[model samples]
Target: MRALYQIAFLACILFSCGCSDSNPSPSDDDNVPPPSGTSSFDIITQELSNDLTIDIYVPRVENASGKYPIIYFNDGDVFKGAIASLTSYKFEASSGIEPFIMVGISAAGHRYGRYIPYNDQWIKENWSDYSPGSINYTQRLINEVIPKVEEDYPVDTKRRAIFGFSLSGLYAAWAGINYPEVFSFSASMSPSFWVADYAIFDEPRELSNTRFYFDIGTKEWNYYVPMIESLENLGFRYGKDIFYYEVPGGIHAESDWASRLHIPLGLFLNGTPEEVEGYEIIKECIPSQSTAGLVFQRLNPIVTFTNGIRYSLSTSASFQVVSGDGVVLEDGRFDTKGGSMTVEVSHGNWSEHISLNNCNN
Candidate 1:
C-alpha cells in the first residue's frame, strides 16, 4: 500500500513539475546578475575545547548593500552540499523563500556527548558513554560562532534563527527558549523530543519574542505526537508564531527534512498572518484500522463533496470536521438524519488517508 502511495506521489510531483515551464517568464529585475554567494569555514572557540567547524554560506546581491538575516543550522557539514540548490531555487523561482546568510555548525563526532542535556537517569543508563555538553555548545554558538560570523559579514541582529534535525534539533528548542535574546526563530524538524525523558517539559521558562516550529512524521513514533501537543498546551499560541506540523508519511531522515525545509523558512521569511485562519478539514467517514483498497483524498480547500449516496442509507454513520487539537469544530450525522452542513476552507494543506468502510452496514 505504501508502495502504491509513493508511485502516485511521484507521478503527481513529476506531472506537476513537468507540466510547468522550466523557465517561466522572469520578473523585471531578473536580468540583473545573481549574487556571488560564498562558502567558507572557520574554527570556533579554539581556547576552551576541540575546535568546531562552522560552514557559512553568504548570499550577495549585485547592487544591494544591507544586512541580511542569519539562519544558523546544526549539522553544517551535510548542508554544505544542500545549501546551493536551496539558494539557486530561491533565485530561479518566485517562491517566498528569502536568501539569508546560513551558517552550518558541525556536530561533534560524539553527537550524543554534546547534543544530550545533562541528565542523571540517562547518564546512568544507556548514555553512560557520554556527558552532556549542550550548555557549552549553546554558549559557543552565541559568544563565539555568531560573533565570528558578524565580524566579517553584515547580519540582521533582529531576525536571527537557528534550526536543526534529530538530536541537534532538540538543542535548537533548548537553546531558543533558554537564550531567546540570541535567536528569535527556532525550528526542529523531527526532533528527538523524547530525549532525557522529556526534560525540556519538566520546567517552564520565560519566553519573549521566541517563535518555534516543531514537526515530525506520523509514521515515525506515535508516542512523539503528544510531545508537540504539550508545547501548545504550554502556552505557545499557534498564530503568534509557534506552529506544529505533521507529515503524514514522513520519517527520520535527511531527505524528508530537506523536502520540508521550505515550510519553516517560508514561515520565518514571508509567512502570511491569516493563512491558517478559517482552515477546515471535512471528512465523510473515518476509516477503520484494517481498512484497505480505499481511495484516500488529499486534504485541500477545493475538494468537491458528494452526498455520499452509497453510505447515506446508514443512519448511524456520521461526518466530522475536527481541529488539530481533536476538537469537534463541526460534525453531524449523514443525510439520513436530516442534517445539513456546508464548509469553506482556504490556504492550509494537510495529508490524511481518508477511507470509507462498513458505513452501509
Candidate 2:
C-alpha cells in the first residue's frame, strides 16, 4: 500500500509494483522447505471501475484436500516473492502453520481513491476524486472480488484475513473494523494511520473478535508509533488477540514489509506444536466429564496451566478454586487455579468449570 503522488502518475507508484517468483532463503536452522505450490496467472475482476487483477497462489500437496483459509493482499501485485518464500517456510511440515490460499489484489493506480477514506481532509486536498460517503473500493472487494475468488477456489470464508502496507494498511484496519464478518484478521505494516486527521481514533472500536497485527519502522514518522500505541490502548489482548511490533531499524518500504511478512503470517496462520496441542487440550477439556489425570504445571504472564493437558485462561479471568462439593477453596484472580482439584473460571461474564485431575477419575 504505497501512497499516491497524483492521478496522472499513478503508473509510477512507489511500492508493490511487481511480482517475484524467488523463494526467500531462511537462515534459521529450523527452516525447512514446504510442499510445492503453483502460482496462478492474473485473474480479471469486473467489480471496480478499474478492472482489478488478482494473482492467486495455491500450495501443491500430494493429497491436496480440505478447506483452507484465505488471505487478501491489498497491494497484491508486489510481494509475490516474499509471499512464496514465507508460505514455503511456514507450511513446512514442522512449522505448524496450517495451509492457506493467498489472493493478491493488484493496486493498479487507484491506491489513493480506493485505500484512503474520504473523511481525511489531508487526502481530499491531495486527491480530487475522493468520494466522501462512498466505499466503492471495499464494496468491490466484498461484493465482487471475494465471490470471484471463491468461485474457483475452496476458501474458508469464516477465517478470512486481509493485509496491506501504508495507505492500504489503513484500508486493512478500516475493513476489519467495518466488516469483521468478512475479515476477522488484519495486518497493517507502516499503516497510514494518520489519514483523515487520525479519524481512526475518533472513538475507535475494540476488535474483541479480531486478530490484528501492527508493525512500524523505528525511524519512520515520529507520531506513527504513538498512534499505534493508542490503538493498542483500546484494550486489545497483546499476544493472544493482537500483536504489535516495532522493527528495530525497519522503514516504510516494501523491503521492510517483505522481510517481516512472516512474523504476522505465522502468528495468524501457524502455531507452535505446544500451542496447537494446547488448543486441542482446551477444546477437549470443555466437554462435560472430560478429565486429564496428571500433576499440573503453570505458565505465567498469560494465565496458562499444563499437565498432560493445558489450559490458558483469558485476560478477563476471575478464577476460583472450588472443592468437589462446590466449596470455594480460594477466590482470587486469574492466577488462582494452581494446585487445585477443581477450579471455576469466569471470563467476560462467562464461567466454566475446569476439572483438574489431581485425583484419579
Candidate 3:
C-alpha cells in the first residue's frame, strides 16, 4: 500500500534545527518541494564497540541545515524488508503523504533481547534465559546509532520519533522514556505489555517533553486493555498530542501492523489522517442481511444492524449475525471499496449474494 504522513502537533519538531538559511529543510509529509537547500544522508556507526549497525534514510531536504527532524523505526530494517516488506516504504517515499528521514536498524539476530526492557526481575521471569545481546543492542541504537546519525547527517536532533511493531514497538517506547532528549515522539503497535506488567510506564525517568502513540486490537488480549487504560487513568495525558487507537480485531504481526500503519501516522504524525469529511458510513450492513457469503469483493466485510450501523462480523466462517426477525445474516459492510461492487452473503442453510456496485454516497 502506498502511504504518506503529515506533521501534526509539531511544536517539538520545529525546534529540531533543520530549518536554517545556511541549510534548508525537507518537505513536509505532503511531498511538497523542499524549500531549497535541504540535504539528507545515511551513515553507519560502529564506534560503540557493540557490533551494531544502522540504515538511515535521509529526507534530502536538510541541506546544510544543522539539524533535521528524525523518525527512527526500531528493527525498522526487519519490519521493512522481509518480515513486513518495504512497499510501504516505496509508497510513503513516492507519495509524500508523510515524509521524513527513515532510519532502519537491523535487529535481524537479536530482536527479543534488545526490544524487551532488561531488569533483574524481567531477566529471571519473562526472559528466563536472557537474550545475550539485547540490552546492549538497544544501547547501541540509543548511544551509538543516534549520535552517529546526527554527526554524520545534517539532521535536526530535536524533532525526532521512534516507532515499530511488537517488541520493536516496545523498544521504541522505552527509548523515548529512557532518552527523551534524543527522541521526543514515540509510537507502539500491538505492544507486548505483559512482558513485565507496566514496567514501561514505570521508567526511571519522566520525559517532560515526550509525546506518545500506543495502539492495540480490542480482541488482542486482556493485558492491552489494562495497560492502555492505566496510562489514560494516570495523569499521563501527554495531552492533545498523544494519539491512541483501539483496532477492533488487530492481531500481533507485521501484516496486522501494516494494515493499521495509517492510523498512527495519521493521528500521531498527521492528526486523524482519514478523510472522514465527505465520507460517512455509506452502508450499514443490516445484521439481518448477513449470510455465509457475506463479503463484498474487496471491502471490509460487515454485518449491518437494524439501526443501520454496520460492523465486521467475522472474516472466517465460524460467525454470523442473528437479526431481530430471527434471520441469521452474514455480517459485513460495503463501500466504493473495489471494482467488483458486489457482496457475498451466507448463513446456516441459507445463502444469497447481493450487488452493491451502485452504492454511491
Query: Candidates 1 and 2: which is better by TM-score?
Result: 1
Regions more than 4 Å wrong, model 1? 1-50, 62-65, 78-85, 92-95, 120-128, 224-235, 272-361
What lDDT tens digits, residue by residue, belong to model 2 across residues 1-361?
1121111112122222221112111112113332376432223334334558877766554214478787898866544444545554334565455677787887765666677764655444444445532277888888878888888778877778898877778788777777777887888877767666565544346645777777655434323324334456776654566555545545555556666787667656642213222221131111111123422122111222131212233223455657643323111212223344566666543566666542223
Query: Which tens-of-lDDT digit does each residue in 76-142 have in candidate 1?
Result: 6443433333455443234444457778776646456556675645434433456678888788877
- TM-score-wise, the better of 2 and 3 is 2
Candidate 3: misplaced stretches above 4 Å?
1-50, 60-67, 82-98, 119-128, 131-138, 204-207, 228-235, 271-361
lDDT for each candidate structure: 0.52, 0.54, 0.47
Q: Enumerate residue pairs that collide in model 2.
A: 120-196
Tell me the TM-score of each prediction against the true structure. Answer: 0.63, 0.59, 0.54
Q: Which ranges of candidate 2 are over 4 A from the true structure?
A: 1-50, 62-65, 78-90, 126-129, 132-134, 224-235, 271-361
Measured with C-alpha atoms, the lDDT of residue 27 in candidate 1 is 19
Ranking by lDDT: 2, 1, 3
User: Would you give me the overall lDDT of model 2?
Assistant: 0.54
Cα lDDT for residue 102, model 3?
A: 62
Error of 2 at 251 (Å): 1.1
Question: Highest lDDT: which candidate?
Answer: 2
As a whole number from 0 to 100, the lDDT of residue 31 in candidate 1 is 31
